[model samples]
Target chain A: MHQSRLTRWFFQNVGLASALLLFAVLFLSYNMMHPRGFSAAVAVQNANETAAIAFLAMAQTLPVLLGGLDLSVGAVMTLTNCIASELVNGSPAQILFGIVVTLLSGAAFGLMNGLIVVYGRIQPIIATLATGAIAIGLALLVRPKPGGDVDGDLGWALTNSVWDFADTYGIAGGGDAWWIRPFADIPVPVIIVLLVTILVWVPFRRSVTGRTVYAIGSAEGAAFMSGLPIERAKIAAFTLGGFFAACGGLYLAIQTSSGNADIQQAGAYTLNSIAAVVLGGTSLLGGVGTAVGSLIGAGILRVISFYFRILDIDPLLQPLIEGVVLLVAVSFGAIRTLRVKNKLDLFR
Target chain B: MRISVSNENKPILIASLFIVVILLAGTVYTLSTAGTAPLLSPKYLLQQLQTGSFLGICAAGMMMVILLGHIDLSIPWTLTAAAMTATAVGGEMALPTALAVGIAVGMLNGFGVAFLRIPSMIFTLGVDTVLRGLMVAQTGGFAPQDTATPLMLFLAKDRLLGIPVALFVWAAVSVFIIVMLTRTGFGRSIYATGSREGAAYLSGIRTRFVTMGAFVVSGLCASIAGVLLAGYSAKAYQGMGNAFLLPAIAAVVLGGTHILGGRGRYIGTLIGVILIVLLNSVLSIMQMPEAGRQIIYGTVIIAMLLVYGRNQRVTS
Candidate 1:
């Protein structure tokens, strides 16, 4: 019984451990390359990258949890950034307002996707793909080029420092701040990622609403028969996903400090978001995953990229590795699903 | 015997509608611009047609996969791989050899999906990446300088008694696919497997093999596309196939082939590819920015899907 439970747990939670392993490897490797590098600074940078990817993955996760995949996450991210830049302009007030607008835009997009999937009776993949294209088109209409500045002072304020020791550069006591200028101090995106975990993921996944997501993911028809708000939960999941993707875009805007359509156009976030979620032991078939696992997954990907950089591997090789990673991850998920289905069939 | 509209006619009707609308739009725009030059100058339209012909050729392959309710996301990379292979073979090798290699790759794709039981999207995507890496490694991240055989150049550039030879190739391939789809057992198998694999399998069809065959056909189509592209350009580059990816899928989808696999026709894809080519040609004539063109491209495809969806439910 214990062994069976352990196997189930491994299938369910292997993603987090993978993420942790990735983080540790990347941490050590990055240090090996830059021996004099500030550990805290690297950690902070890793966190920021993690938050952005986590949110993006979570956004995609909602649809997947419902046995749907959204291919338009990349387009949505680009569009959100473009709209935010146009709306937010260069004021601090605009920044705050932009956040709201971005989330709302994501929600609006998600709502449309949900409605189509439910009412149009189209497959979720197809429906979401069309919606994603629509969102991207809308984004293109807003910003043709990657030109727009966030309020520099605001960007700095948000991305810069908190305590005296932790400026945009590395921490205070870590040698002259001159050597660490490139690796700026505590990133706000990381803080937001942590807060989101505490606020959104913790209570939500544990709550009835979260369970509804899982139940629906496990079996939509069953969930519906059991009196769950199937359509609403799907909409909620997608909406939250859009909001998170938007949040990712916002952080990306800060990271690059400018808005270009091509920023993060590498398609990394789209694939990685899915990978991270799956790696975090969130079933690709959906209805099973944790934000913490996603967080870890995101960290692992970043670490992998960092390692590639450290090892001086060709940029193209990264995609190859990612492809392998995706195959391995999905294969694992597929085998597990096959096992569970078989076991359940035995009872029948 | 009452002859009700057969399932085949549906794609025909939709394709006709698209052709009419696109032609009308093109004509109207041409008329509006007639004062500057002849509204539909043969030279001008021919140039536009030629420019988008490459995309049309590729969409032909991509559409077949979609008809099977599977996608070759790696068309982009496959295109790259074919180009690399063709470029390496150069003008000295017989066209048959180059063509054979391309077909082999397609067969490999079929094997991966049908035999390996992997998802088409992920599997093809992996193939695309691996091939891209191979291409980059082979060409060292540069467009290869290759000399096309005289035959290739003639095929790509020369007209056959006033019609382009490429047009001949297109016609032949289309007829082949159309017949294979409508007349052959394999074609029926493709539709059956895509629309309802479980039922098809129970009915004694080798669904896995059929799915695999569809992928091989898809690969064949992509490879042929590469050959045409290489011939047209006189050489292949590392990223020569990059732009073909979205539009190939778009053409297939727009042709009214269900993105989810099953229940589509080659005719739909053919018209869809033509429509997209014409649209882009017209847009470029208007001097639109590259980015704006992308925005418009995405919007138009979505709009087409929405319209197609409504019609699909009504008819089905």
Candidate 2:
């Protein structure tokens, strides 16, 4: 009986498990095809790129868990990138202040979205769609063109290896340096990702508010009837989404070492995040999935592009392939709909 | 479960009045500043009406999809794909081929949503991305060399009497749509399916067929809009249809159609289309930057949604 139960759990989490496997295979293949052969610099560069979308995917997961979608997350990320680029310059104190303000602004955008949805009675999709436009407008206003610098020190610290082990041990650069190889392999972005997963997502997952979010997603009427503080939970979920979106923007700024208010990029991120969430096994209808799943999903999506590059496929076909992948992944989730006893339940 | 005709007409009536007020206000502002009311001039108004016709056609289709509580985000790419196909296939075969492509895509969307049980939003979005990629692959990142056919140009840009032929085509299409929604059993089924899919199914409405039909109609309208747009521009280009998606949706929602489906009017959407066209013209006249324009466009949708949404909550 226990073995059967374990098998059931494994099947239930098949999406996440498959995603992990896909990610591992893709990463390994990419490393094999890469000329550098799994060096720290290469890993850090790839990790930095993956971290941005991963953070955005994580941001999107919370609202999806609450049965709401936040289309403004990408716009918030763009806005924060613009804010950070404008303010995260000069002295370290100044950069710290800029980062704080940028994060706060992201939270504010989320608060506005929550209020509009909860109080204005507008649907989440439409509300966030509007706010997303406004956020993009704000981003454009902040950075009319893409040419603002962030603090150099902060950028280097976040994007580089944690320790320059070869230099620390007085070994010359470009040597086989076996002893310091593992130390140099630790990318700062990867470490930050781990820290966030442990510090934020793990605790949040076990909290009452988090449980309430899932409850609301699963069945809002039942949650409300049971006095589950629906409003507070929703607001908190959206706010945290904004916070994470800002983190994504901050990472983008660090990685690029500049800022851009490109609506195309923002729109792509929003769509990709949704795709990632689905890839992660999170139900769009809400109430299931985890942050780890989203991380893996993000990794899978990023690696797909890299895998394509390695295979020498035309770059133009990327969106087409990605779309097919998304459709197939989402359809997997929909298979259960076929079993509904009543056709009407299909609409629900 | 049927809404009274009078109740349905109320929102349209109010929207029409609002459009008149906006036009007059814009005219006054223009006249006060420039000593002439160019926007109110018959010629300019007629020209703007031609532009509004494109959006009206697209919104007309969107209204049907929205009526069924599903959205077709693939409109932009579907339109683009059709236009590119038509233009590339130029000459007499252009119009029919373009429309056929739209219908094929629309049917695919419907099949996925109805038979495959995939969510309309994601499914259509995926279809859109695929279409976008196909178009890009076809064009190799440059504007197509083929020009719009003479017939397309005549339909889109030529005048009949003192009015644009586009306006007449839009009128014909709108009239047909209005009849479909009001005078046909299929129209009633659409509303029923959107309002309560299960009940509609139980009532033998063939909800899947209705859903597919709505999508097919939407796809047809979008393709027609694309053909017209190609005619206006004289050539189809990459990303040409991108500008229409949000505005088409915004116009439909602004017309007070429930975004969740089951209630709305074609007249309201008509008025909504005119308002957006006029607003765009006025904003252009004022020389507002693109960023400011987007902000206003988004704000307007939100304001209208709040006003309409509040009423919905109270009634429910």
Q: Evaluated with lDDT, which candidate comes out highest?
A: 2
Please give the TM-score for the first chain of candidate 1. Answer: 0.81
What is candidate 2's TM-score for chain B alone? 0.94
* Candidate 2 local Cα displacement, residue A237, angstroms: 1.8
Chain B TM-scores, listed for every candidate in order, come to: 0.88, 0.94
* DockQ, model 2, C-alpha based: 0.51
**lDDT over C-alpha atoms for residue B292 of model 1:** 65
User: What TM-score, over all chains together, does every model reach?
Assistant: 0.84, 0.92
Per-model DockQ: 0.25, 0.51
Candidate 2: misplaced stretches above 4 Å? A1-5, A33-37, A164-183, A337-344, B1-14, B311-316
lDDT of candidate 1 over A298-328, digit per residue (tens): 6666666666655667775665675566555
- For A297-326, candidate 2 gives per-residue lDDT tens digits of 998888777667567788877767877776
In order of listing, the candidates' clash counts read: 11, 0
Q: Write the per-residue lDDT of candidate 1 for residues B179-247, one digit (tens) a residue.
A: 989999998988887777777777888877787777776677677677777778888777677778777
